[model samples]
Every structure is written in structure tokens, then in C-alpha cells.
Target: MKLNRLELDFFRNYSHVEATFHPRVNLIYGDNAQGKTNLLEAIAYLSSARSHRARYDRELIMLNEPQGYIKGEVDSRERTFILEAKLNRGKTRQLWSNGLRLKTAGELAGILTTVLFCPEDLYLIREGASARRRFLDGAICQLRPRYAQALAEYNRLYEHKTRILRDWQENPSLLDTLDDFNLRMAQFGARIIHYRAHFVRRLGEQAPAIHADFSGGREQLGLRYETVSTVQDPLGSVQDIFESLLKHQESHRRAELDSRQCLSGPHKDDLVVELDGQSAKQFGSQGQTRTAALSLKLAQREIFQQETGEWPVLLLDDVLSELDGKRQSFVLNRIQGGQVFITCCEPEKLDGLERGKSFQIQGGTILSQRSV
Candidate 1:
């Protein structure tokens, strides 16, 4: 899929702006904090109906603005679609596709798939387990709407269970409902664990070869999905996982009550990365970690393409400058046959790339456009 045009109003720093995009590579160049990342964020928001950088819709609106808007013309599955989103300060965001209102944000999942690579992602290897889990959730949510619904249900159950645990001491009556919440959490958490395990398995199959090639066959990469010990097989059936979660939850009931925390479920799951049989998070050097992260992202893109039969739009937010020439070349060479938007401070960094369109953005406005 590709974005043909984008129109933004009161979104981020862009007050009123519209720009067309090339189906191939499009370079967006600007200095830091000059709206380069903001523009990319808008496009990413269109794909997922949520901002990667902001937790609230109010944060996306311009200063003193009551509301914001983002509209895009997307080409997917041999047809054109008009996707629009309206952001309000104190209300729910509205979303529409092809002039029809969508009931839920998950409805926009498969319409436009995007893979974003930002500077923060370069440190994904050493980041906390939440970040890694987010990586898994974001990618899977876009590809499988069922996973998104299951995740939402699991998180909601987790929150209710935690609140009951936290307040049960004050009101013993709350304990009466804990078992019901625990049962529902197990049902949803089992589905989440199943999906994540399958995704990680596929990622493991695809990422190791890419990492070996990126490292010139000097390094071997591996991925393992870590969940509660009761789960004998992550790839097992839903019933098996549900039983396992129940067993683990029962075992941790006393400890959970003592700590007043929800400590046994998919919420604490992790994706472990190994380089040459050692933990990448604990032992990999800076370069090795970066390469591992890149391989993982590229593998994600490939997995999307394999499942959907088309390449997802690639968004690189000033990530090339963080990589050396060899690694940059490796990434650029691997991203063919798809639409790409790359933001960079130095235009010379793209000098060796093939011809494409280039835009100069300044102060949330498009200054000029030229063929690169």
C-alpha cells in the first residue's frame, strides 16, 4: 500500500499543509525539531490510529487549537481509499475510511500497514521488556485484528484485577470478584501468548539469516518468546495455554496478595534475543545491538509482506545517521519494492541513493520540492 497524498490541519506543528508523496522513495530533510518527525508521525497515525510519540490526542493538536485533522488518500488492493481522522481535546477521536465511519480503531488495522524505524528503536535490544512487548504487539495488531481485540481485553482485565488486588485489603468484598476477573484474564492472556509466540517464531525464522548477512556471516542471531513457566509450549493450543495461566495464577495468588500486584500473566512476557548463544541485552556491544535491532525490524517488514502479499510502507525517522556506511547500505539495499519516507538532517547522506523526490520542511511547512 502507498499514500498518494496527505493533508494535515492543526496537527502537531503543521497548521494547514498538504503534500503529495511518491510511491517509491521520498526524502524529507530538515533540522531537529523543525517538524520532520511530526510529518512522519502523522502518516504513522493514519496507519495505526494512534501516535507512537504521544499518549493523548490532545498532545497532537497545535497549541491553543481545539481540534486537529488528518486526511490521506491511500492506494491499496487495487483501489483508492480516503482515510480521515479528527482529533478533539476532550472527546474520543473519530475515524473514517472511504467516507464510512469506523466503529473502532482496530477497523483501520489492515488498511494501511507501516513499519517505522526511529532512533529510539536502535536501542530496542537493551530497552526494558515493555518496549520489546510493545514491538510485538504493534506489529501483530496491525496484521491481525483478532490479536488487537484480544490484547485490549487482556489489558482491561489486567487493570481490573490489579485494582481489586490493590483495594481488597480495605474492602474484603472486592476479593469476591477477583476469581471472575482472573478467569477472564486467563482466557484473553492465553490468546495473547499464543499470538506472540507464533509471531516470535516466524521472526526467529526470518531474522537470523538477515542478521547473518548484515554481519557478513560473522554472527548468528536467535529469538525466544519468554512467558510464565507454567506454559510448557508457547505454540500450544488455546486450551493448553489457558490451563497453564490458571495454574500459574493460582500458584502466585498468595504472593500477589502480599505484594498487591498482578504478577503472573502475559503482561510480564518478554522476547529474548541471542547473539552467538549469548544474551544480546546483557552481552552484545553497541554495534551488535544496533544490527540486531535492524535485523528484527527488517524481519518484521518481511513478515508483513509475506502474510499480506504486498510491502508495507517504510518510515525511517533519522535512523540512518545512527548507522555506519556499511550498515546503511545494507538497509537501503534491502528496502526495495516498497514506498519509503526517510527523514534526515544531511541531504548528502542520501547522495548515493537512487533518484527519488526530496522535500525541504521548515517550521512545520513544506519549503520546496525537487527531484533527487
Candidate 2:
């Protein structure tokens, strides 16, 4: 899927802006805090109904504005779809596709898939499990709408179960409800885990050569899905893991009550990034960590293309400036002929980037008609 044009109003730094994009390679260059990231965030929000930066609806609105608006035209499945998002004060964000109101985020899924590579993504290996989990969940959700729904259900079940446990002393009856919740929780949680395992397995198959290429063939890389219940028996169905979850709920909750949280299932799962048979988190250098993160994201894009029959729009948010020439060349080689939206402070920092459509961003304004 490729975005043809984008319009935004009252979103972060952009009060009002509209720009058309080339199907392959578009660059937005500006100094810091000049709305480059905000523009990309608006595009991402229009596509996914959420922001990769984790900005809340209220936070996304301009400081003095009561609402935020985003509109985009995308080429998907051989037809153009106009995707729109409206964020009003004290109301849920509203979404529309080609003038039809979308009832759920699932309706908006696959309309425009994007793999964002930002400087912060370099933390995927060294950060806590939440980052890696989000990486896996977000990528898989875009490919499988049902997986997203199942993950949402599992999280809801986890919250409800936690509430009951927190008030257990005063609400003994909630335990029975918790019992019922755990059963469904396990069922949905098992499905999410299964999808993630399958996703990571595919990543393992696709990421090795990518890692080698990105690392100049000096490093061997692998991705492993680390879950308590997902892989105990690969040949078995999620039902088996759910059965195991149901049986262990009592003991797990008894211990977790002391900590006031759900202690088991997909919520606690992690992705183990390995380099040369050692944990990257523990052994990889800063450059290696970033390389691994880049490999994983590129692999995700290719896998997404294979699964969906279309390339995901690529977003590179100031990620290339830090790479050495060799790695930058490798990165450039991979993104040559795709729809890419990039942001950088200095235009000269990007090699062979000025040849593409260029925009100068300053003071929340996009100067789009000029090349320099």
C-alpha cells in the first residue's frame, strides 16, 4: 500500500498542511522540533487509528485546538481509498474510509501497512520486554486482524482478573467470575501466543541473511519466541495451553496477589534476540543492537508483503544518520524502489537522498512545492 497524499490539521505541530507524496522515495528534511515527526505521526495515525509514538487523542490535538483531523489517499488493492480520522475533545477518535464510517480499527487495517524505523527502535533489544512485545503484537496485528482482536480480549481479561484479585478480600464472589474469566482468558491468550510464535518463526527464517547482509557477514543472528505456554508442545493446539492455564490459575493467582497483577500468559511473553548463540541484549554492542533491530524490521516488511501481497509504506524517522557508510549503503539498497517517508535534520547527512521529492519543514509548516 502506498499513500498518495496527506492532509492534517491541529495535530501536534502541524496546524494545517497538505502534501502529495511520490510512490517511491519522498524525503522531508528539517531541523529538530519543526514538525517532521508530527507529519509522519499524522500519516501513521490515519493509517492505523493509533500513533507509534503512543500519543493520546487529547495529546495529539493542537494545544489550543479542540479537535485534530487527518486525511489521506492511499492506493491499495488496485483502488484508491480515502482514509480520514477525526479526534474530538472528550470523545473517541472517529475513522472513515471512502466516506464510509469504519466501526473498528480492523476495518482500517491492511488499507495502509507501514513499518516505522526510528532512532528509539534501537532499544528493541536492550529495552524491557514491553517494547519487544509491542513490536511483535503490532506487526502481527497488521497482518492478522483476528490476532489483534484476540490480543485485545486477552488484555481485557487480564485487567478484569487483576481487579478481582485486588479486591478479593472484600469480594469473594469475584473469584468465581475470575474463574470464568481465566478460562476465556486462556483461550484468547493462547491464540495470541500461537500467532506470535508463528510470526517469530517466520522472522527466524527471513532475518538471518538480512542480518548477515546488514552486518557485513560478520555476525550470525536469530530470533526466538520465548513464551511459557506457546511452545511447550508445538504440535498441539492453543486449547491445550488454555487447559494448562486453567489448571494453574489458582496457584499463579495466589502468588501474584502479593504483587497485584496477572502473572502468566501472553502478557508476560518475550522475544529473545540472539547473536552467535548469545543473547543480543546481554552481549551485542550498540551498533549490533541497532543492526539487529533494523534487520528485524526489514524482515517484518518483507514478510508482511508476502502475507498481504503488497509492500508496506516505509517510515524512516532519522534512523539512517547514525549508521556507518557500509550499513547505510545496505539500508539504502533495501529501500531503493519503495514508498519511503524519511525525516532528518541535515539534508546532506543522507547520501543520494536529495534526488527524491523534497520538502522543507519549519515552524509547523511544510514547504512542499520547492526542491531545495
Candidate 3:
């Protein structure tokens, strides 16, 4: 899938701007804080209805503006689509698909998916499980609407359970509903684990080979899914996994109450990355970890293509600057046959690239646009 054009108003630093993109490679160049990254953020928001950089939708709006708007024309699944997102302060974000209002962000799945690689992701191997979990959730939510719905409900229930566990001592009545919450959480958690297990399985299959090739046959990469201790088979049917979650919840009920924590569910799931049978986080070198991280993302992109019959858009946000010449060339060489947006401080950095569109950005505006 590819984004054809984008129009923004009061979004981030942009007061108003409209730009058409090249289908192959779109280069956005500007100094730091001049809105190079914001351009990519807007494209991703139009696709997923969520901002990778901002924690709240209101953060996406301009300093004094009460609301922000984003619209993108996309081509995917052999059809064209117009996706829109409205960000209102102190209110829920609204999304639209082809002029029809959408109730959830999941409704925009598979239309304009993107795989973003930023400087922070280079440290994915060394970061905590939450980083890796976010990686998985971000990719899967765009491909599976049901998984997205289940994940949203599971997170909401987890918050309620946390409040109950923390306040049960002062409000004894809250304890009355704790059992009910546990049962419901398990019901949703089952789907979360099932989908995650299958996704990780596919990732395991692809990332390892890619990692090996990236390392030049010198290292082996492995990915394993880890969930609650009581989940024996994460790939089992939803009903069976639900029962397993319930069993684990029962075993942990006393500890959870004692510690005032919500501890039993897929929220704690992790994708274990190993290099040559050792934990990559603890043992791998910087280059090894970086290579492993790149392999994971490239593998994910391949998976998207295999599933959808079209490659997802690849967004590289100042990632080439962070890599060495060898690594930079490796990444650029591999990202073929798909739409790509690369942001950098200098257009000369990618001087030898084939013909594509280039935009010079300044202060949230496109200073100049040209075809190169």
C-alpha cells in the first residue's frame, strides 16, 4: 500500500500544508526540529489513527489550536481510499475511512500500514520488554482488527483491575468484583496471547534467517514468545487458552491481592531475542544488537507483503545517520519494491539514489519540492 497525497491543518508544527508523494522513494530533508519527522508522523497517523511520537492525541494539535486534521489518499488492495483523522483536545480522536465515520482505529487497518524505523528502535534489543511488545502490537494492530479490539479491552480491564487491587483495602466492596474482573480479563487475554503467539511464530521464522544473513553467517538469531507461567500452549484455541489464563489467575490471586498488583495476563508477554543461544540484551555487542533489530523490522515488512500482496510503506527517520556506511548501504539495498520515506538533515546523504521526489522542509512547511 502507498499514500498518494497528504493534507494537514493545525497538526503538530504545520499550520497548513499539502504534498503529493512519490510512489517509490520520497526524501524529506531538513535541519532538526524543522518538521521533517512530523511529515512522516502525519502519514503514519493517517494509516493507523495513532501517533508514534505523541502520548495523547491532543499533543498532535498546534499550540493554540483546539483541534487538528489529517487527510491522506491511499492505494491498497487494488482500490483507492481516503483516510482522515481529527484530533480534538479533551475529547476522543475521530477517524474516517472514505468519508464514513469510523468507531475505532482498527477500522483503518491494512489500508495504509507503515513500518517506521527511528533512532530509538536501534536500541530495541537492549531496551525492556515493553519496547519489543510495542513493536509487536504496532505491527499486528494494523493487520488484525479483532486482535486490536481484544488488546484495547484487555488494557482497559487491566486498568480497572489495578485500581481495584490498590483500593480494595479501603473499599471492601471492590473486592466483590475482583473475581469477575479476573474472569473477564482472562477471556480477553486469551485472544491476545493466541494472536501474539502466532505472530511471534512467523517473526521467528523470518527474523532468524534475515539476522543470519545480516551478520554474514557469523551469528544466529532466535525469537521465543514468553507469557504467563501457566500458559502451556499459547497457540491453542481461544477457549483452551482462556482456561489456561483462568488457571494462572487463580494461582496468582493471593499474590496479586497481597502486592496490590495486576500480574496475571498477556500484558507481561515478551519476545525473547537471542544471539547464538545467549540473551541479545545481555550478551550481544552493539553491532550485533543493531543488526538483530534491523532484521526484525525488515522481516516484519516482508511478512506484511506476504499477507497483503503489497508491500507496506517504510519510514526511515534519521536512522541512516545513526548507522555506519556498511549498515546504511545494507538497509537501503534491502528496501526495494515498496514505497519509502527517508528523513535526513541533508539530501546529499542519499545522492546516488534513483529518481524519486524530494522535499526540503523548514518550520513545518515545504520550502522546496523537486524530482530527482
| Candidate 3, RMSD to the unseen true structure | 0.8
How much does candidate 1 score in TM-score?
0.98
Pick by TM-score: which candidate is best?
3
Q: After superposition, which runs of candidate 3 have C-alpha atoms over 4 Å from their true positions? A: none
- Report the Cα lDDT for candidate 1: 0.94
- Residue lDDT tens for model 3, 241-358: 9998999998998999999999889888899999989999999999999999999999999999999999999999999999999899889889989999999998897897767999
- TM per candidate comes to 0.98, 0.94, 0.99
* Candidate number that wins on TM-score, 2 or 3: 3
lDDT of 3: 0.92
Task: Please write out the lDDT profile of model 2 over residues 1-372, one tens digit for every residue.
Answer: 789899998888888999988777788888899998988888777666777886578889998899989999999888999999999988988989999998777677788888888888977899999999999987877777788788778877888888987897787777678768878887897788778888998999889999998767999998888776424753258787677666666568768667767887778889999999999999999989988998999999889788878888999898888778887788888875558888888877776763657888999998654543
Candidate 2 CA-lDDT value = 0.83
lDDT of each structure? Answer: 0.94, 0.83, 0.92
Query: Is 1 or 2 the stronger prediction by TM-score?
Result: 1
